[model samples]
Target: MSNEEKQAPQDQVEDVIESEVAQEDAALVDELTQANFRIEELEQALAEAEAKAAEEKDAALRAVAEMENIRRRAAIDVEKSRKFALEKFANELLPVIDNMERALLGTVEDEAAKAVIEGVELTLKTLMTAVAKFGITPVDPMGEAFNPEHHQAIGMQPSTEYPANTVMLVMQKGYLLNDRLLRPAMVMVSQG
Candidate 1:
């Protein structure tokens, strides 16, 4: 073959190689771009999944804390219920206790024995202490203003010794549990 012909063939081969290399480079660039896009998509999905997981964890923690608080409150409620179970019964017994106290303190016109009086007084004081520990208290509104909420005006007495609408005498003492009235004070209010 001639020299020019050989050079022509060599140049054609170089051109073919360059074209093939360009095609390969283009394919590689497209693959790299596709891979980058896929990576970005995967990263977004991962971030979303992580965020969702964090939110779920926080929700679960809050729910658990709420349940714990409820359990603690329930326990406290049960304890309070047990402690105050006698509240109603004690309320009912307040009148009896007051009657006992009144009977013991009244002028013994009858020939009552000294030993009997001492025994009765001691019993009353003891009972009063026990009920007092359970939040029961006596309301002896003697000389205090007669409050309609705590006092019952059974009789009106005209007296210059006391102000009007004042409790002259507590006929039967009242009792209270906490702030609740077990029995209202039976009182005689002075009208004068």
Candidate 2:
């Protein structure tokens, strides 16, 4: 109950309170460090996600561009097909034109035959004009140099009127449709 006894009790109480406050400060520091580490981890994860999203977006754009190019190429091919669609029909009609020409070249001894020949001549000319307008052109190789691409040599004959390897006679005329060979001219070439 003296001064020293009273001072001892007061000092004990202050030391207990200081220890508790120090423990609380240590716990708060630990929590703050943990929070900072978590923030860094979240920042790294966000950066990775953003980079992945950018890569996916770029891939999608490239795919769209490639598809557009393919569509454009397909449209061009379709247009070219449409332009050449009449090639087969024109080729089939070439024989009919040849027959008409042969009929017109026949001798007309009687007046009735002459009139019929004249009518055939007119028809052949009209058909030729019609075919020409549709990009159909005749390949008459007679007296021209033989070309393997445009002329098919059926026979070889000795000829003094023209040079060797020249087209002496075109057995059947060929045809072209829009600069493309529909058929090669069947011809007899002069032997070298």
Q: TM-scores across all candidates?
A: 0.71, 0.70
**Model 2 segments beyond 4 Å from truth?**
1-54
lDDT of each: 0.88, 0.92
Per-residue accuracy of model 2 over 114-140 as CA lDDT, tens digit each: 888989989999999999998999999
List where candidate 1 sits over 4 angstroms from the true fold.
1-7, 109-115, 141-172, 178-192
Candidate 2: Cα lDDT at 44: 97
Q: Give the TM-score of candidate 2.
A: 0.70
Candidate whose lDDT is highest: 2
lDDT of 1 by residue, 1-192 (tens): 999999998999999999999999999999999999999999999999999999999999999999999999999999778767778899778767877776677555445565677788888889989888888888999999989989999999999999999999988888777667768899999997
**Model 2 residue pairs with clashes:** none
Model 2 has an lDDT value of 0.92
